[model samples]
Target chain A: MQQENSVSKLKYFPVTAFSVVMGLSGLAILLYRAYHLGWLPLWAYLAAAFTALVVFAMFVFIYGLKAIWYFEEVKKEYNHKVKVNFFSAISISFLLVSVAFYGYLPFVSAGLWYAGVIAHLLLTFHTVVFWIRSEFEVHDINPAWFIPVVGNLIIPVVGVDLAPTWVNIYFFITGMFFWITLFAIVLYRLVFHKQLAEKFIPTMFIFIAPPAVIFISYFRMFLNVDVFSMSMLSLALFFLGLLVFLVKDFFRIRFYLSWWAYTFPVSALGIAMMIAYQATGFSVFKYIAVFVLVLTAAIVAAVMAFTVKNVVLGKICVMED
Target chain B: MKNVTVVVVYIFGLITGILATGFLINISAETVLLKEMASPYDFEKTVEVLAKRINSTKNWHVTAVIDQAAEVKGHGEGDIGKLKIVQYCSGKYAYEVLADDNRKKISVMMPKTFSVYEKNDGRVYIAVMNGSFVGKIFKGETYEILEKVSLEVEALLNFINFKFSLF
Candidate 1:
């Protein structure tokens, strides 16, 4: 049984520890120089850094709490090393920040939004090699575990906004696959390999956050690309849901009516598209047709699932126990 | 022993002790001087377009001033009249956000900044933010309209990169 205080206590570390540290470290150098030398508008840099740092600090505290909770869940003896990964991740950020602030402009800061690009490319390469030969074998990797860690790595990548496709695809595919595969693995493990089914909560952002971005990106809002890239994002999230529901190992309470949370944001977008297609007056029949289109799509997906072997199930079935 | 470890990992948590966010926001300034604006963004058009996109936002101002405008001393034609800084925020939302919690310093990044400028010999540069970054600060119960607002900002920035050749 899960303890109440324990579970409640273990929140926030992953979000805070690495993200804030690196983000500030990378960006703070600029603020520090501006203030000491009085080069750029000090107020804005200070404000962004201060705000980001405070938020980062709280998130770090929360991440630590979660680490403690994880220790509590594992029922393991612990100390500061509980957040060893987090510290290292933050350490890297510190290193990058220090390097960045010392006036090492690789190209251009582009915009702060692109800051993740640098970190993304670096981690993308690192993670790709790491994934191709991940030492963490024998057990299924946790999406929550990897997202923060890899994200910690890529978090710094945004230092500049753009990178060649080859750079990002490596990280993008690896990151997405890890989570996507994690979702698949969870399903089969729940069905047949029960022992491997640990407390699995797919990181909230793994699907909802990123793919929503994929859709937002579809407007060609930030990066201009073809429809297929955006469409794949929608497909990725859908598969994520398929993986979530297919798994018996999930935090069912969170799922109770959450398919709606998963569906509404995206589907309404489609409905809006339909409205645009019709233009002007409302048609009840059109609304019905739109409803049917969504329902049919969901059904098609479910049908496809039956034909596909569960990734975890396939793995377990082949394992020699 | 195993269960005990779980309890401990469950106890202290990973990021508990550090004050991860605000430290940097309030930090003393330094310049890495990394930003190389290939081309300056047309802030006037950007502000006009963006103001209409955001709901309840008021007194929006965007500028493309010399590096001296930011009060920064230039090194090699450093701020040589190349960069643009865009500052924007919503009026009522700012008030509502501040009133919510003292620690919601994330919200204080309101009237946020988006800088656009040109690198020497001209490469037009334009950029804004990712939704996830802003989503953290918005903190509404429902991501419904908030998600759209985030998307709109991204879209506006993308438009600059696309139609205006900012990117």
Candidate 2:
């Protein structure tokens, strides 16, 4: 009876599986960024991008059909904010891949990039309008709503030089404002409302992302360091410190693909520090950048290896058996 | 009397803030474009001569000569005049920049590109990204190397301009 129960518990096509893109692409860009910063050799960027592409391809092939199933499953629960926003992970993954390859293949990268842009526009519009149109409880709010918003900020990293100036500004303004609005809502939920569901606790790490990403995007947009850039960096550091204090709480949650949620925000902060070091030439920031890079890289590597092992063992995709 | 003084101070502060911001914006807007002179030579001859001159330069190797005009024409767009980007990289500088973490970011702007294009007026122009100003934003060994590279870039453009002047 216990064996049957275990088999029944398997999640062959969890929507959360798309989140592997977050780690794989995040690390790829991290390596590429490292290559740009001279932390890694030239071949390192190529190798990292190749690895991300392979993993992305495998994900598409392995979960392609099941993804449809996952979509249907989630669509049934579409009223849930978490399920609805999880769809944004797919779009965000495409954005990350586009950024990883952008330096190498501009034309092809642009194609994937615009796909992400359109996806974010459509998904965010639908999700936000649904929120405003519906009569929802305050407890429904969570950091995952920030996922859809984060994509706008991330667009400028790839789009600033590649796209038209107006387009770049559009994404920056949209992302910046939404982030502020969502930050207030998510913060209010955290303080006034009850503790989030266990699955959601890992996503608290996402709070680190807005400032981290804004730092990068703002630097790129202005090509100069100023009060705004410094403020973003400070906020990112503050969030990083906060996450560290909650490290024990992070470990208490059951491991799921949602754990991938923790990778990109820290990765963004790592890349942000590198940008700050470049802009200010501060050694301390460089050290912090390297430290964050190493820690995030290691975390991503461990999580990915464990995930692959679990997948192979039929412990993940297979029904509870 | 106190309220009147406070109102005057607030007005003065707002005007000063606006003027300062306007001054900053004006300074930021002053970007130097890398455009060189109009060549009497047509697109084909200019690109050919430019490619030869570039390859002749020490440590500079032309990696690719992209025929962007052919590409746009391939898209069924009616003929736009010849536009080509000649990509070249200095193996020496590549090593220098790639040697350290801070310098690696330079690769984003790497494989130095020169766009050679002709206008509707039949004038051919050569231009590059403003390297010097971009380099100044970073500090460290990367900044030193980038500054050096920017100077080298300026020298190359001047040399090309001088060559065209002789024609």
Candidate with the greatest DockQ versus the true structure = 1
lDDT by residue for model 1 (A95-148), tens: 334333222222222222233444444544554454456455434443334433
The two-chain DockQ for each candidate, comma-separated, is: 0.06, 0.02
> Worst 10-residue stretch by lDDT in candidate 1 chain A?
A312-321
Say which docking band candidate 2 falls in: incorrect
Predicted model with the maximum lDDT: 2
Off by over 4 Å in 1: A1-140, A153-198, A201-232, A243-321, B1-122, B126-158, B161-167
Cα lDDT of model 1 by residue, B28-102, tens digit: 112122222222235455444544444333333332322333455433334454455656664544555466565
Model 2 CA deviation exceeding 4 Å by range: A1-12, A61-64, A67-71, A77-79, A313-315, A318-321, B1-127, B130-167
lDDT by residue for model 2 (A228-257), tens: 777888999999899899899887876667
